[model samples]
Target chain A: MKFTYQINGAEHTLTLEKHPEGYRAHLGTAIYDVKLLHAKDGQLHFQLDETRHTAHLAHETPAKRWLHNAGRTLVIEKAATHRRGADTAGGSGRLTAPMPGQVRAVLVAVGNEVTAGQPLLLMEAMKMEIRIAAPHAGCITALHATEGGSVNKDDLLIEVEEIPT
Target chain B: MPQFDRVLIANRGEIAVRLIRACRELGLSPVAVYSEPDADALHVRLADGAVCLGPAAARESYLDMNKVIDAARQTGAQAIHPGYGFLSENAEFARRIINAGLVFIGPPPEAIEAMGDKAAARTRMQSSGVPVVPGAQDLADDTKIQQAAATIGYPLLIKAAAGGGGKGMRIVHSAADLLEGAAAARREALHAFGDDRLILEKYLTDARHIEIQILADQHGQTLHLFERECSVQRRHQKVIEEAPSPLVDESLRAKMGAAAVAAAKTVGYTNAGTVEFIVDPVTRDFYFLEMNTRLQVEHPITEAISGLDLVHWQFRIAAGEALPFQQADLTPRGHAIECRLYAEDPANGFLPATGTLLKFSTPPGPGIRVDSGVESGSVISPHYDPLLAKIIVHAADRTAALQRMQTTLQDTLALGLTTNLDFLQAILAHPVFVAGEATTHFIDQHLPNWQPAPDIPAAAIIAAALAELHSPSATTHTTASPSQDPHSPWLRLTGFRMGGGE
Candidate 1:
């Protein structure tokens, strides 16, 4: 059987074949003998060639995998056709939440004039407060985040249409 | 003084768990207060009794003084331990706790008031014959600020009078930036700390953040438990802390230790507190930075080296006990280092990450201590501090301790969210850190463009592929088969997959 995996934005194909002792897998161009040492409770303890590795799968979300070995973690996910980027990338002049957090305060309102680098809102996450600033001098056209509202990463918070001097 | 048979911990997270363990060790009952979101928290589960304060917001729960006091009263707890943040440094909270006939396991309210304000603490330190950074008292007006700036010269700092953790702090390189810097500092201070007052100090560019851990009792006995160098920081928040700074010699340690004791004595400080200092690496001269009037997040290293239980001492002191050991009797035996594991994404400017901790495994061994309130299935809420745990390792020397820390960090696994664990490993392996040449500007000087781990092992990739194939949705697909036929040439694999969802 041939399997495809996406890791850190790169994809590779693994071809698995049955063996008398164990299983042989050809990952990309390299071939290795794979041994399943232990597997239970979302944990995978396996051996590839001479090296051993442990991978944990989330109980609820099985498509995501946390692979641990050699003092490093590789988070792999099933490749999706569409990728999510910062929502403000299309020259919309909109500010988006940099990470998941709660809006501590919405300092600016719709139609409020703001200067470049002026703080427009305060967001709190992980017990730290981050100030959201205007990317450029503009008037606020829309505000999507309210005080105490929870926001996710890449969620649009405010739209600022730059004013031509 | 009353006997503290049961202590109410008016805090949450790792520190609360730490206090609960200490209370249990000392044969005292621990009463934990939790917010609505933390009803199933590890600390609540570990405590002898638990009380629901309010919602997830700190203002409505942990910081709510009345509710905390009422919980203590209802639980019949004789003492209250305000761990680290939250209401730890609030003087009014101490006053209320003491007035309500409960022992506050911290410094006196007078001491808290004097040291709580950074500007006032500097004044007190200077008056007590401690060397402070060249600066002026609180600058109330523009003229006063300008005058102070002239004396202090350019390359000065505008700091919030009642601030810590880098909040309301600004640097001015020239006269042109002084007013704006001071204004912004005042505004931020007002918003973050509720005090708009500002202070000016001659900023030292190349300095090391060295702090002394001091324990005082009611009988005027104060002693230093040695020093911890916490120069490795980002945005003025410490991430890596260790005991016995590489720069401090016996003479310098004695000098700084005496100064820390004097500062504590001047403020009538009691219980466990830290006196922070900024030491110039070249001149070896030290100046008083400020005094933290409560348990610090990095206190574990001090405990690891000195073999002392700081929380136990706080409880003993608050219960009207004297210092058990004199200054000369205590000495650090080994070296210890602590890495703060935070739920943050190093690839994304260290932004906080929130989620249900789908997988959390702690490395266990001798000389390794993990103080954590989080576990498998724990929730990493944005409503509180991102600190998930403190991974502390003690060894015979710095070299061994560093090696142990690297290994322990590798074994420490946390999934389902972004974390600073790998970033911490990178720091531990950095050449500068290995050479013990790190200063206050260490992180900025090195690893400024810290990216996430670059390479993925082939084994990991293969395992991820297998897990994906074994997933429920993938099993239902047309091509992939979930189960294996042993008699045939196919071998089946069973493992759980991590689903990246909210």
Candidate 2:
């Protein structure tokens, strides 16, 4: 079987085939004798060549998986054959929450003009207050965050449209 | 006075758990109080009885003194222990507990009030012959504050009089920024501590934060538990702590300890408290910072070295017990270090991350201790502190202790949500930290642009790929008998499993 996997935004082609001794697997340019002992609950215990290893994986979404191994976490995704263009182009004008938190204060209104580094809102998380600043000088076209509202990571907070000089 | 069988812990998190353990060892039943969000907290689970205070907001729960006292009454607890944060230093709370005929496992309300005000504490320290940093006190307006700032020279700090945890602190480098800085500081102080009073102090650019732990009894006995160096801070909040301070010597420690004892005596402080100081590295001069009239978050390091349980002593002292040992009999054993594990992403501006902890495995071994309030499946909410745990280690010497701490941190496994674990490891391995030269500005100066490891290792990539391939979904696509095939080469290999064999 062959598949394309995206690890940390980089894509790699991997192939696996049965061998007399375990299985022969080709990942990118390297090939190894992959002996699968067991796989369940997002944990894979296997032997690569002579070395033993365990990897934990969590299904994040249809296209994304969180892989934890070697004291580090890497987000891996099954590469999609088709690309969506609207999502990529629409991100520039939107402000998203950097982390999960509560919006303590919203300093900008829908029609407010803001500078690139002007303070836009205050977020409170982990008992610490953080000031979210505007990314660029623009007119606030939309405000999605309300005072004392909870926000998750990547939640759209506001939308700004650039003001033509 | 009544003999209390049950102690009420009017707090949440690790300190509450710590108090519960102490109470159990002391033959006292512990009753826990929790907010709605913390109904299933570890502390609550460990206690003999638990009561829900209110909602998730601290104001409605932890900081609500009446609610806490009422919970204690409802639980039939004769004594109340307010762990470090929340109402620990609230004088009114202490008074209420005492008025409710319950022993407050801490100093008297007067002592907390004296040390609670930074300006008042400085005045008391100076009068008691302790060295205090030169600055303005009790300035009524910004004009006077600016004048005082000018007299104190540039680079002075404006600190909240009623602040702890660096909530409202600002540094002014010149006259141009003094007024605005004071205004910002006042605004934050009012918001965080409910007190807008500000005090100015001479900013020591290269000073080290050293604090002496003082334990006193109602019998008028007082002793110092030496000092802990808390210089490694970010935004004036301590992240790492150890005892004794690398900057202090025999004579310096004695001097600082004496001053701390004097400060405690002047305030008639009872129970456990800490007198903080700012030490000039070059001249070895120390100035009084403020006295914390409650058990500190980093008290474990002191326990590791002294072999004494501070919380247990707090209970005993509250019960009118005398000091067990004299100043000469107590000797610190060895070096100990503590690192605060926070739910934060150091790579992304150290912002706090909130999510359910998917995996939480603590490092266990000799000379290692973990005081944690969280575990796997625990949700880190935004309404409370992000301190997940404290990883502490002790060894025969500083070098050995550092090594042990490094190994323990590396072995620690906490997945899901971002954390400062990797960032902490980087600090521990830094050359300056190894040399014991990390001052308060070490993190800001050395790692101003520090980033987490950008890429995964080759082995990890391969393992991840293989794990994905052998996932249940992928296996379902293959022949079912392949997994059980006696002739299958995979059967020849040793037992291997993925996804924890679920």
Candidate 3:
């Protein structure tokens, strides 16, 4: 079986084949003889070559997994075989909630022209206030966040159309 | 016997757990109160009794003084311990608890009120012969604010009069930004603390935040527990704390400790309290910042060095005990460092993260203490503070303590959500931090753009791949057994079987 995983925007492919003694894993040009020592409840104890490592893997979604080992955690996602093109409608002008929080105020209205880095909204999360700003000089085309409304991570807060230089 | 046999802990999170343990050690029945979402919180499970306050919104539940008092009454609790935050520092809440014939395991209402307001505290400290930062307060209008700003000069701070934890603070570099900065600070202050009053202070560049812990009994004896250095801060929120500040010598320690005791005495404070100060690292001169009438979040480091359980003392003092020792008898033996473990993304503006803590583990060994409120399978809700735990380490010296803390952080693990663990390690490894020369601007000046190392280890990738292959969902494409096969080297992992495993 061939598996492709993405970490920090980079993709790596791993191929695994059944072996009589254990399993053979091919990661790039390096081949690894892997032996599973113990596996239970998201905790995996395995040996790759001469090193023994313990890692915990938890699945957040079908394609996303959190892998932790030796005090480090990495967000690993199964890379989609079919890649999508860039979002042309909003591009860099789309503003989203950085984290789950409540919109404290909306500083800009639809159709308002904003300079780069202009404050557009205020959000409250974990008892701290954060200011959301415009990414570039643009005109607000849509406003999705309302005052005192709750928003999830990556939820669209605003959309802006870029102003030509 | 103590004055109260049953005590209600009127808070949640790690502090509540810490108080519960202390109550048990003192042979008192600890009762816990929780909001709707915190029904299964670790504190509730560990307490002898628990009551549901209300919904998840803090205002409706934890912060609702009426609900908390009523819960204590119904639970048959004779005393209430507001373990920091929530209603811990609220003077009205303390008075209400007393009026209800329950012992409030903190200072008197008069003390809380006097020191709760930062501006008022500054005035009182100045009158008590304590050095105060040059600033002005109670500026009701733009004209008064402008006058104060002119006197304080450029690079001043606009802070909320009723603020802590840096919620309503703004720094203005020059005259041009004064009015705008004050307006923004006022709005934030009103929203966060329900008070729009602002105070102006001259910004102290590269100053260290040192605080003295003072304990007082109802019998009028007050003694200081020395000092804790909390210089590693981000936006005024402390990220790391240590005891016996590297900068303070015996003479400075005695001076700051005496000033802290005098500050508490001026307020007639009782139980455990901390007096914060802003100290110039070069001259060793310190100015009174504010007095926390309740226990502080970083009290564990002080406890580590002083060999005193502050919570135990709070209970004893509330029970009408007298001081058993003199100030000279209490001495710090070693160095202790504490790092706050928060469920926030350090690489992403330190924004809080919420999810189920699928895997939670702590380092276990001598001189290592982990005060936490969550366990595996616990949910990190968005309705409360994001502090998950506090990891503290103690050793014979500062260098040994720092090294132990570094290893302890490396040994601890939390998965299934973003955390500041790696960022904490980075801070521990920084040259300035290791040298113990960090000030309040440590995070900003040293690691303003810190990001976790981009490279992922190959072993992690291989483990994830193996786990994926062993998952029950992958059984469709391969003939791997769903159960652990004795003859096979690969053990089939169970739990969280995706896609309706057969």
What are the per-model DockQ values?
0.12, 0.07, 0.13
Docking class of 2: incorrect
What clash pairs does model 1 have?
Answer: A57-B498, A58-B497, A58-B498, A61-B499, A62-B497, A64-B498
Q: Point out where model 2 deviates above 4 Å.
A: A1-17, A23-28, A36-45, A54-67, A77-165, B187-196, B472-502
Candidate 3 DockQ, CA atoms: 0.13
Q: lDDT tens digits, residues B45-65, model 2?
A: 999999998899999989898
Could you give the TM-score of chain B for each candidate, in order? 0.92, 0.92, 0.92
lDDT of 1 by residue, B1-502 (tens): 3487999999989999999999999999999999999999999999999999999888999999999999999999989999999999999999998899888999999999998788888888887899999999777799999999999987999989988778999999999988988889989999998899999999999899999999999898999999999999987889999998888888999999999999999988899999999999999999999999999999999999899999989998988899878999988878999999999987778899998776788778999999999997798899999999999999999999999999999988787788999999999999999988898898889988898755667777666555543333211111222223354221111122111111
Query: B422-457, model 3: which lDDT tens digit per residue?
Result: 999999999999888999999999999998898778
Place model 3 in a CAPRI quality band.
incorrect
**Cα RMSD for predicted model 1:** 15.1
Q: lDDT of all the models against the reference?
A: 0.82, 0.81, 0.85
C-alpha positional error of residue B57 in candidate 3 after TM-score superposition, expressed in Å: 0.7
Task: Give per-residue CA lDDT, model 3, range A60-160, as digits (tens).
Answer: 65357777787787888877533123255345877788889977656554435678998778777886667788888876656677666899988888876
Off by over 4 Å in 1: A81-165, B468-502
List of chain A TM-scores, every candidate: 0.45, 0.46, 0.49
